[model samples]
Target chain A: MSNKEFEQQLQRSVAQLTKEIQPQRDLWPGIEHALNHEQDSQPKSNSWAFQSMAAAFLMIGLFGWLGFNQMQGGDRTEQLVTVLSEPYQQQKQRLLASYANQPALTDNWQQQVQELDDAAAAIKLALKEEPDNPALLKMLKQVYQQQIDLIERVHAPAWQTI
Target chain B: MQTQGQLVDAQEHFAERAVLNLIEAVKAGDKQAYQMLYQQHLGQVYALCYRLTADRALAEDVTQEVFIQLWRKLDNFRGEAKFRTWLHSVTSNVCVSYLRKQRGWWQRMFNLENSEAMHEVAPGSAGEVDLDSLVQRLPERARMVFVLHAIEGYRHEEIAQIMDMAVGSSKAQFHRAKQLLSEWMGYEQ
Candidate 1:
């Protein structure tokens, strides 16, 4: 081919090149997993702040509940706990399953989760003693929300931050 | 009734609006929105990565990394440029960074010499006369310059910035890429 023809052919080939080529595999699943894993691998110092925040929320929630109980009366705590805990547990299970393969951001993330679980169990026990107390029910709900938030922040922190 | 051109324009506008909405939803921590964005852009992103890296596996990894980083950095996108343009820039940077990390210091120092062997081991090496295959045979720097400039419509100056080379070097690499590709395609000077 002449020089001009060679240049023309190269331009033609470049123009004809496909701008999109699909991968042989579905990459979304792996990407999704990595997104979760990336958040779970953030610095450990964030974990300390997370734990402190959860503790403060719980303390505030408990004090607020105590004061509220003095002004309220109800026997629906057991039923309400059942309503909240059942769905919370199922959602927690799904979240855990979704992030099952990811390593936690901190060494003690699992322990932190366990601590929340223990706190929830203890709150449930307190609710049993005062099954009529709306305050205990409120505490249970707050604890459950905190657990969910903790799992979420660890797994997909971008969502939480925004 | 709308003319064909007007209809096409309307469709393009609608598509742009939908992508903008998806970006907003993704910024709000919507996983589904993010996934939609991924599905929409992955093919183009993968194509750029694949052509730039000339390796299928590395392209796949780079594609994933681009989307993963996109999720974290979506908040920074202030809608100043078209999302596709921003994403193309992001994908190119990620591919470059990934390539840098994959190569050892010695290989980077001798990148031009070492990359010539990449053509030998590159997939579809035997009897494939397609332009892409020929592109895969290009040395790394040359391939990147050609892909970014010729295929991706980037100016030599932009490519120089992306690759951290002088504009003259970018032009030289592009010329080298075209010459090599022409020789492989059985075109004479």
Candidate 2:
């Protein structure tokens, strides 16, 4: 037989090929299980973010108060720092617990919060040498507020926009 | 009254619309709608997977992976192309990736001499051969090129892109596939 005739026979056979074939077993159960497993593990994966943020905030508050005592300038600075941080730490813990089940709106919100905590720590370290330094106190206050704003923004009801 | 051709067209249109609705529901996170879509397309996806992988068990695993990926990526479909076309593209990519990950299995099967690869002869006259069985017997690249280009209606350019080879190589593999298939079918030059 010529190549042309052979090609025609091949084409006919190709055209006759079935487009669908049923699998010997049901595959949907496996796929559904995988998808559900993914959904179930999502919150557990985000648990690390919650832990990191909580640890960062605790360190900043602890370091700030410790620095106030080290300076020994006056009891007023220690009192003020304690007043500012005590309630803030309580609120932070509450918010983290409440939002533990919810996925964060942003991937790097925890990182941003950690950076702010680092800034707060450095300011507190400076305050240790000059406890009455108003500029450093203001800066520390700004950092703390920024952390609160970030946490609130990430878990806000309007998070869909973010 | 509609003509027979018109009636068939209307039915097809209705089916197409139903599939689009299911896609929209799936994008909205409706699991039932996704299951409906799965039941509707599993056979077609499995067929592509089976032909591409050339192994029943591997095909089953690849088919499941394809659906899992479909669930994750259904949101990316912008309706610019027919869903089935997009799905076939997805299945082809998944099969290629899955096969690449199972390179050891492919190496074992590639040695067709030791591999009990082509045992299912077509159930017909003694000389009649199943094209799919013959395709499974072809060298891996040749089988992939022929299946994509001839059976799946992919152009050599598209096959090259999908298989990550040069277009010339795609054409060469296809030519080699045709020659082997013709020879296996007992056709002379």
Candidate 3:
């Protein structure tokens, strides 16, 4: 084949390529986590390395230490909040599935979730740039907990009937 | 072709405007605007990383790393050129620097992949020539050159500067990539 023909063939093949290839996994979550984790420590520090395994339970510990004293006897709302905040993936998945399909009692849940999603995306992006900031990590966790609480609160049948 | 060119120009103008607005927001420390930019440009960033590394996992890491660097370096952008152009330059630098650092003298000579992920995908999945599989099989320098030049529309001079190689070497690697691509495509046909 002529060199021009070969070059054309190369161009044809290359042009057929898509400019974007979706990753096999959703990488944003990891990116967000990494950014936050790194921000809590030095660029080369291993201090926040444990954060990968320190998901929802970190909040559980925080909430328990902070506000568990306010509640008297076994408050179901507080109890369910603790359960919703659990970090164990398996248990959390099973627990969430039970309430995943229920109709929300509140009308604004979708908008609330959209706001949380946007907040989370924005936090992750910032975390991508600045990884060791404790304030950002706390904010990210709080935003996440608010999302969980919102979901649980909306679906709690005893609280409101819609 | 003319219509396509016009369409590309229009899209570019629109993107330039969006990027200008985003850069202003980001400069004011608007993290959300930076993320908006991330979502807008991630596909191309990721695609460049994957094509550069030829390993899916590494590409993901590289993609994240590029954006992280971009976030830190966002202020350096003077807006003289399109943001995409600036981002592309950053992506290229990060990927190439990574490959250089990861490759030891012997590894570069032997042309070994940093990870075994490349071999995980079969050469002919679903009974057709997998161009990705073929591209991954390419020798490292040639693959990078092919991606930058043929796929990304980079001139040999720009590639030479980016790869820190002679202009003639860049052209040679590009040719080598095409020759191999033709061979693989021919075999499939």
Worst 10 residues of 3 chain A by lDDT: A153-162
Clashing residue pairs in candidate 3 (N, C-alpha, C atoms within 3 angstroms): A38-A131, A39-A131, A39-A132, A39-A133, A40-A132
Clashes of 2: 0
Query: What would the TM-scores of all predictions be?
Result: 0.63, 0.61, 0.57
Model 1 pairs whose backbones collide: none
- lDDT tens digits, residues B1-189, model 3? 999999999998997998899989988867788788888899999999999888887787667667666766788889898788888988998888766644433263334734354334344232244566678877788899988987788899999998999999999987777776666555331
**CAPRI quality level assigned to candidate 2 from its DockQ score:** acceptable
lDDT of 3: 0.65
Who is ahead in TM-score, 1 or 3? 1
Best by TM-score: 1
Give the CA lDDT, 0 to 100, for residue B122 in model 3.
41
Off by over 4 Å in 3: A33-162, B1-11, B105-130, B187-189
After superposition, the stretches of candidate 2 with alpha carbons farther than 4 Å from their true spots are: A40-162, B104-127
The worst-scoring run of ten residues by lDDT in candidate 3 chain B lies at: B118-127
Distance from true position, residue B55, model 1, in Å? 0.4
